[model samples]
Target: MAVAAFPDPDLDPSRWVPLRYLNFFRLVIAGLFLVAGSELQLGHEAPKVLVAVAFAYIAAVLTLGFPDAARRIGLDRLIMLQVVIDIAVLATIMWASGGYRSGIPVLMMVILAGAGLVAQGRAVLFFASLATVVVLAENSWRFFSGRSSADFLQVGFVCIGFFGIAIVARLLALRAKANESLATLRGVALAKQQAVNERIIRDMQDGVLVLGADGRVRQANPSAALLLGVDSLEGRLLAELDESFSDFRVRCASADGALQRMRASGKLLRCRAVGAGEDGEGGGGEGATLVYLTDFEEILQRMQQMKLAALGRLTASMAHEIRNPLSAVMQAAELLTEEKRADVQVRLVRIINDNARRIERMVRDVLALGRREEALPEALILAPFVASLIEESTLGGAAGRDVFRVEIPARATLGIDRAHLHQILDNLVANARRYCSGKPGSVRVFAVDAGGRTALHVLDDGPGIDAAERLRVFEPFFTTHPKGTGLGLYIARELAEANGATLELADNAPGAHFVLTGRTQP
Candidate 1:
């Protein structure tokens, strides 16, 4: 036959009840009282026998009733009852067993010490005072009855020992309580700190992943799970999850080296996975790898946008430059064709020459769209730069300036490439002048210190762009006019972004409004 073993109760201090220990102590004390009672019954001491019987009965009551009492009235209340019982028992034993001659009066010290384990403050003082009064009364009674001087001295010593024990026990219990309180406060603070750290990690926009030593997924933040297209990643292994993400897992498992690769979505993503041992120390676990994913989608999109924009600008600039030469050629051909005195065969030659020059200019502007360049930048101020650009434009020149107006402030300065700013403003002003022609057309230029940056505005009084064409206006070769290259706004935006600024079309009363905003560095 096999014997069954009972499980031990949990003994964690925070979860422990002092009543359990108290009950155990009560049983031990009952056994002592029973033995003492049996001995007194066997002896011829009548008073001692009666005292022992009473103590035995009291001990039995404590052993049998304490558990139920503790449950009904709480441990703290039961402890107070136990203190009163101890005082009464001690006084009765002292009075019965030869007054002060009975050395048992000192037993109150043990009870006081035990009380310190469970009771405190007023309870401790109450019990201690009770024991003192009982001891003092017994000694006074013994002295009046002519008891021996040695017996009195012995009782006095016992009373002193009782007080000494009670004081020491009370101090020790107070210290223990302080230590426990400090420990609990520390635990609460640590838990709060950990929660904050977890929140920060989960709230990050970039994908973060942690892998176990066996190349299994350990943890993934919300951003990581979203990037990988999963609901949750608690139990899934890294290799078995997604085939598209398998390359990262395989590279991490091989232990060859840290791996970095670019993956494409609508735009490119820079994915980096590295082993845990960059400092040359082995991983704390085994083959764990840390993975980081940064989305470069916006960067690639902006690059494409810039290319189309530069092409537009090049075409527009070339077209404007070629227009002057083509016009002169056209006039010369017309003059030749009108001269009736000239040979009749030469008239066809002049007509062909006029059309050919027009065709050549169109072809040159179209071809200039494919050009690319990487130019260095420099520091430039906006207020003066706008003034210079307006001066250089045909409508802005001193002789032909009556058609347009320019306004600017003197305080706007920024760190930018001077030539790029000039090119952007020139294109904008030229576009406004062309659109507002034949209606007393005017272009207004001004700058304001907007927060930490500068805002430059170019407003024109002309026909405004329709809502449908506004979005596509920056696309390469998409133009409203037959002679326009349609690259001005696109190129201006590209150049502005390259210099860490932005060009945006603002809402205007009649004509187009262009605003360039850039950070001003001291």
Candidate 2:
């Protein structure tokens, strides 16, 4: 039985080249035989027969070795036919040139070994058997016709050698095939791993670049391309892209440290470079470096969120502890005010009551931070909602109806929790009313469609916020107003975010403008 046959050429493309190489080997051997035979006058006793056999052999090899002919006849059959032809033609040439004494049969060993390899050790012993039979028959015929003396022992040893070589060739071919299969499997696995790595690099938010010793980009992921403000980064010099990259590369190569630099595109990136090796050790001879870029703004935002989270936890715990003492202080102040005392005593009681009430409001706002109720959002028409909020704010006679102007589309809608929206608008409008001039249109409430969301803007005619104060206006317990608890805007923003909305202070020139951007529909 033969070992596993070579994989089909249609399935494994590597199979086709070896078969073509075998055919070419056969052609070369045939041509060499014709050339050597004619030059040496190999068949002096039967020159015409020798020449005719040689030409016919060459013609047969060419016809059978054609690529299309092999494909049409099928690979196994074609290989079998080629090996058989090799045995017959070579044996005939040996007979014409004084039989095995001419050393022509030695070439038969090469044919047998090659056949075993090409067919992946299949049917090799059969071809050896056929060659052995033909050689022995030729010896028998020569002895019987008195043309030459028979050496049966010599022929037997040669036949044995043929079988031995064929068997060894088969074993070698089997080992070769096994190794090739293992290598192919490893190659496939490596390719899959490479694809996964590429996908990870491509989808990463941080930019990554691989640079060679020449400071040129050998490979770059999509984020790297975007950060560099280029379409592609491969094969381009870092210095050519930007001077900052050159400096960054130099700084990183000298030592492992990050370079925080802003690019021409106005993006602040923190770049760090490391050797492309295990544990950031030196890589190959080319000295490759892996550069990473992170956005500075995002880093700052993350830090701010961490700080705020810690503050919330601290304030929530403190508010719980302060509530009981704060209530006691207010009751004591009220009891003291009931006594008929001096005018100075009355003024001191008033101050105590006012401060106690303010602390109570602050404690209430702080406690609200811990209770984040789930928002139930619904769509509300813009004009009527603002009109109703304005009416409620003015019912206390703090301002007249005409003091505030509502400039919203009648059909425009906003998506938010009903109570949450009312609270947000009330806080904004009240803040606007406190700051604006006491005149019509001094405090304006307007709405505009922003993409699929609606932005509700509350503008006042009061002095606009300072540039330095803009960033901290939404922070809890941070306010410029003396009487303000400062948690109103913070709580309002928290509620806005709970309903998938954003409240921000827009940079309007004349006055403080707060914009509440929310979904246009529920």
Q: Would you list the C-alpha lDDT of every candidate in the order shown?
A: 0.64, 0.79
Model 2 misplacement above 4 A: 1-16, 38-41, 120-122, 143-147, 229-236, 240-242, 253-256, 278-285, 321-522
Candidate 1 segments exceeding 4 Å error: 1-16, 36-77, 91-107, 139-161, 185-189, 242-293, 296-522
Instruction: Tell me model 1's lDDT, rounded to 2 decimals.
Output: 0.64
RMSD in Å for model 2: 21.7
Q: Write the per-residue lDDT of candidate 1 for residues 317-433, one digit (tens) a residue.
A: 666756665676667667666767656437656655655665574565454323224435565666666666666776455655665665555666876677667777788887887
TM-score of candidate 2 on Cα atoms, chains taken together: 0.56
What is the total number of backbone clashes in candidate 1? 1
lDDT of 2 by residue, 319-359 (tens): 75456557666775776768676875677676677667778
Question: Each candidate: how many clashes?
Answer: 1, 0
Residue 323 deviation, candidate 2, in Å? 5.7
lDDT of 1 at 17: 48
